[model samples]
Target: MDKKTILTMVLAGFLGLAQAQNNSTIAEHVKSATAISKVLGDGRKVATVILEYDAPISNRSLSPDSYEVEGKEVVGIYSNRTPETAANGTDGPYVVIEVKAEVDLDARPAPPTEAEMQEKKERDRMQGGPGLRAGWSTGGSDEYPGNAVVLQKKEIRTRTGKVYRADGNPIVTTVETCPVADRFTQEEFVSPYTGQTLPYNIFLPENYDPGKKYPLVLFIHDAGVASGPVKQPLYQGNGATSWAEPEAQARHECIVVAPEYPVITVDDNWNYSHHLDTTIALLKELQSRYSIDSKRIYTTGQSMGCMSSIVLMLKEPELFAGALLVAGKWKPELMGPLDRQNIWIISCEGDSSSNTLQGEAVAIWRQQGSDVSEATWEMTQTREELSEQADKMRAEGNHLLFTHLTGGNHRATWFVAYGIEGIQDWLFEQHR
Candidate 1:
């Protein structure tokens, strides 16, 4: 063959080899795209999945289109989400191209199969005994006529993790058809010493009758707030009205009596001791009218309400079963005497004042030899995590439970802490 012809043939063979290599690189890119789809079946799992291909070519070029997944019908696309060009003096036109595929998890109902049902039953059997019960009880009262008021109680189907309703009913289980009071009744009692008439809202469980005595809870609000409009002292908002009322009542089957502290700030400072005195008086009078279990009386408060709770427990430790203090500060010296009582101290990180106070109280409680459990958590801007942490704390133990929310502000933490479902659960658990 002629020299020129031989050279031409050799050049053609080299060109063909280079083209083959390019095709192999593209095939590898396709494989990577498929792997990405496998990783992101549901878009909710990840926001975006990116696949990169580095080629030897000087000019970085991406495929115009993406491969489609079969059966799943998910589409893939090349995204110039981030384009990076090579620095000067670098190889020609070389760039780094990243292709991203966005997949969203479908929101569809997943019907439980027979196997799932059997698995759930087996799981429940393995868990053994009821998970937890809410509501007040006279330590398993037998004299009280008929079945006791049972609110939130659940039989779980798993030991790992499960979501439950506010009433402690499992969401995955058969729907509970239990009946509850349509509208709670309110009763007021007047304290002659302070000339303060306190209102207590009574929640009668479904089929409630005056013939039987029921367990009771005394809820106190911070100063400057009344039970409600009209000055009905006994008509203060219980769990059923203020926030998560139904959940609170269901979890702790008791007549929650929230009394309004007089609006007067004693001596121009917040003196809760006086308000607590009136509360005790009002409670004593109610005890005479209602069959309240003196041993099971529990106290809980938020912010100023929490302050009053500490003072009340200090002043009359013998009167309460336990106390849950949220975002409130108290001197260890003042709480020293009440160390014999079960106490829970909660605070948020953002509020340095309350946080410092809470830390001091915990330290004092420890010094006094009180059994205390504390859990401090980070709070998001939305306060969702704070609520979750409070609920978890309430569920873990009813007596002496403290939950700290990280990044939470003072005001928002109080409201959320007071409204947690676990609060009532913790209160009632003391009776056990």
Candidate 2:
């Protein structure tokens, strides 16, 4: 008989056997077997048959892991595998062939008992797993013996060598570590061209000697801020603060030259063009007096001060090794015409003015094929989360770094941006 006729006859016989036994048969298992044989057959005198039975025969169950049919008298069974009596086996009647078949049964795990669920809920509540217990503060109390149960505690010693909490908690509140300002000799220098008396607050390193030449960071203040000769009472704004003095000088290991602009503005408007001339004069005067490293000199500023740095770069790109512009606007037309310089742009996402201007500058710089690294401060997420994303980007060959702060506004963004760990190390790594 033909292969098609043989297959039809075998299917009819299986259907008859299923009806006689009062058992439902699946036609799909037989159809799959037939399809497999047809693909494997090489024009040999072979036939494919579909069979249905309560238990699969030993030869047909070739592989427990793979789905296939083999051997003579292949009987396809769709039922749960269980040890049963087999009269023909050497292992006795209790040894039965294992068979795996699709069966309808409950596959889900049993629901927890009421008492068990209540126990778990209580355990979670004590551990502050979630929900209402999330805000439960432990404040370094010894009552919470387990380290995992303590909310937030860090080891710290006060200036007086007293053991205290570093991170803020209920028991140990955050203590401000404001340092005494280091005394430095003040000097005034006259501008050669304009004859304008310009004063610079020169901070010599703690271990300063006349023989050593030191690296310098020229910090410029924004408009209406007098920061040169007279140390004005510290007003915090534009990403800089008086607190920055001790931290920056200690960490950077450099002398800070903060120059003041007399009559900070020529007219009512804060014109960077006018202040640029004064800055140039002041830098020259400072260079004459102090043994400053020309190649290692860096410039950075906040707000209008940042604008001044950009203006200085435009006039004399070779003056400084690198520039960090924070929350400042740069004119796109002027930027395109300027020579390439090592630039690091920093701005918060909330600062609309800086974001718009800096975004434009980045695009233009990319088009010009200039080397620039941008560090952005986004206020939507925490710092740790943003650092993770920044690390991923670094892996993907992008120079942009991001510092995200939770509950950060435009004003407070710079407090974290400039104060990022190893910021100066990253900044000075490259010089052009």
Candidate 3:
């Protein structure tokens, strides 16, 4: 249950200019870039690197905030190594370092050069004429270079003036592509029952073969509010995209179906009676088309999606092996059927009183069960503690886990739950 730090997969030349330098003593321990996250509004990119070395690391030298990209000072550093104390060596031989920098703010596109403009003009002429390509281009323009946001390797320097260059090349591309084979794919799910076509994102195993059966994770996305439009799960929450991330896909290759529900509904209901039917129909259609392990199907979601997941758990418990419901209320009247399935409910302290009350309902329900262990999350458990609790729950043959996130934002409760180390693995292990 140790929460393995999730690293972003940076492709070759991930640090384009950074890798040009000769490898140094530090480069000997350099591993691939595990992950990168962008805060567009903040004009920064947080990149994580993994290093394995025999010698002890200099705390200040390895600190994430101590590194810089293109001379922009790193705003913060977080290392997932032993004792979080200053320069603690007990936690290492291997360390994961998160380097945060204003890479985007400094990499703003420069005005196009005359030569480039002429080249674009000529290319446009060949394609059909001046302004034609620009008109057709989705976001490209003659005013500036399109695709200018290249993820280059920036210079990495410590606070003490020491510099380090990557000895390794990028193993993945930062440019997001569609239908990336074995990765998240955007496609239409045609429901034969309603003759309705819904847009959805599915992640297939990298080594997918028709001959093999894989688990199916049906993620129902929260619908924001009753008045908003229905969006794809990935749009609903970034965490939903994690199912398709290289890290998650690598850990447990499965077929993840995130369907978009129509926005024309009352009270933002996602898992209501009629919608549940359509959702199931969608699932059936997906199953018929893909190599899905019928017994290993699972579902998880937040808010509206969580409600939907709960409804599905009740109406069609036979269809799912497990369910993780976050930031949603549970109806006691309908609790009768949930006992048959493996369920985990999570909420945050910042969540609405209704969410916390639901957790209490789950706790009360657990007391009536023959096999149940009740623990208050109080939003205070560390990641390690959460993992241990997850282990203990599975060990005790408990069917329900209600955890309260005491301090995080309620809107993001699901994100943190999804980030938990063994949660997804635990769900995947359940089979009817």
- The candidate that wins on lDDT is 3
Q: TM-score for each prediction?
A: 0.50, 0.50, 0.59
- Superior by lDDT: candidate 1 or candidate 2: 1
Error of 2 at 247 (Å): 5.6
Q: What TM-score would you give candidate 1 relative to the actual structure?
A: 0.50
Question: Which stretches in model 1 have alpha-carbon errors above 4 Å?
Answer: 1-187, 210-213, 224-244, 264-270, 380-399
Q: Over the stretch 1-432, how does candidate 3's per-residue lDDT look in tens digits?
A: 012222222233234424533332223434323333322211113333344334444444444433333322344443334312123333343334434432121232346677757865775677565532211221122121001111224334333455555434332312221112214667776666667666666777768899998998887765432222222344334445555555667788788887666542112222243556677888887889889999989888776677778777777869999888877765654575576678887877777654656755665576657344555454345657777767766676676776666666656576456645567767877898
Top TM-score: which candidate number?
Answer: 3
What's the CA RMSD of model 3 in angstroms?
Answer: 12.9
Candidate 3, superposed: residue stretches over 4 Å from native: 1-182, 225-232, 235-238, 264-273, 363-370, 378-385
* Residue range 386-410, candidate 1, lDDT tens digits: 5566577665543565677767566
Q: lDDT (0-100) at residue 377 of candidate 3?
A: 57
Clash count per candidate? 23, 0, 14
Question: Per-residue lDDT of 35-147 in model 2, one digit per residue for the tens?
Answer: 11110000111122222223233332222222222222223322212222122222111112222221111112235567746755775688557322211221211110000
